[model samples]
Target chain A: DQQVKQNSPSLSVQEGRISILNCDYTNSMFDYFLWYKKYPAEGPTFLISISSIKDKNEDGRFTVFLNKSAKHLSLHIVPSQPGDSAVYFCAASLSYNTDKLIFGTGTRLQVFP
Target chain B: DVKVTQSSRYLVKRTGEKVFLECVQDMDHENMFWYRQDPGLGLRLIYFSYDVKMKEKGDIPEGYSVSREKKERFSLILESASTNQTSMYLCASSSVTRVSYEQYFGPGTRLTVT
Candidate 1:
């Protein structure tokens, strides 16, 4: 069974608009969530992460909201730029020091002008 | 900055051949992981090591083995290459520091088995 899932395979958004990507996980034991962005032929880079203790965490233009009760989390990118186009993956771990991370299938985001 | 480097960016091998993929981390990380990325499968862990000479099986470990003779170098070995094993292999390493679980990934190696 897939513990973490990204139902949408892809998403398209207009530049300067808000882009929302959703992730759902079945494992309730997960306490740490993270998002990573990947470009073609490149390795995934860390984007943002939120601990289960908090409901939300925000960076400059990116925000990750976690609804632990709903077993869902969403990543919001405001003022999406063309440079933001890439594959996004959401991952979950049991704790902060867990070595294993369960990752979602990933959502490909395309921001157009 | 933490840097993970893979031995090859691309490799092609024939069936039944023994294949080896190497990974090295610049930072003194205690944990290292090897994952294979396939279409619609995200990243599946093949193997991982938390210390020198200690290895653990991940979600998938069949037909694969790992070696961690040193703290910074980890090797993934395929006993016999199979066509189904063709995929992109990614290497990652993370420190055992508190409050930090971010894993640094290498460029990845695209392996093809024919």
Candidate 2:
């Protein structure tokens, strides 16, 4: 069973525009969600995350919105930059004390100049 | 600074040959994980260890085994490699922080079975 799913395989956006990535989950027990960004050869780096209690969380140009009723969440980047182009993975876990994280397939974001 | 390093960034092996992928993490983390990444399948966990000598199977553990003899080292063993097993393998380590499991991953091992 895929507890976490990123339906979009790829996305394209213009520089200085907004870029949004979506993710959904089947497991309701997952209370925490995270976003990871990766370059071509490097391992994924942590981006931002949100808890179930909050509807949205923002950090710099990155923001995460969680809709518990729909079991869906999304990442938004305002004024997307060319440097932001990379693969983004959505992950979920019951809690941070546990190491088992369910990751999505990943969405490749291309910020076209 | 904490670091996770894999023994190989790229490896090639013949079918049916035994293979070993080694991962080491500094920082005395209590958790270590092994996962494989395919084109569209995403990151699938093969196994994870919470402590030395203790391991638990993840979503995809078939045809594989793991060893955690030391807290900082975790090894994944493929008894009989197959072509279908060709993929990018990743290792990660995490500390059980207050309410989150933020993992740090290695560069990854791209294995090819010929």
RMSD of 2: 1.3
List, residue by residue over A12-79, the lDDT tens digit for candidate 2.
99999999999999988888889999888677888998888999999999999999999999999998
Q: Give all TM-scores, in the order shown.
A: 0.98, 0.96
Off by over 4 Å in 2: A95-97
Candidate 1 C-alpha lDDT tens digits along B1-114:
668999999999999999999999999999999999998899889999999999999999999999999999999999999999999999999888846568889999999999
lDDT of 2: 0.92
Best model per lDDT: 1
Candidate 1: lDDT of B9? 96
Q: Write down the worst ten-residue block by lDDT for model 1 chain A.
A: A93-102
Residue pairs clashing, model 1: none
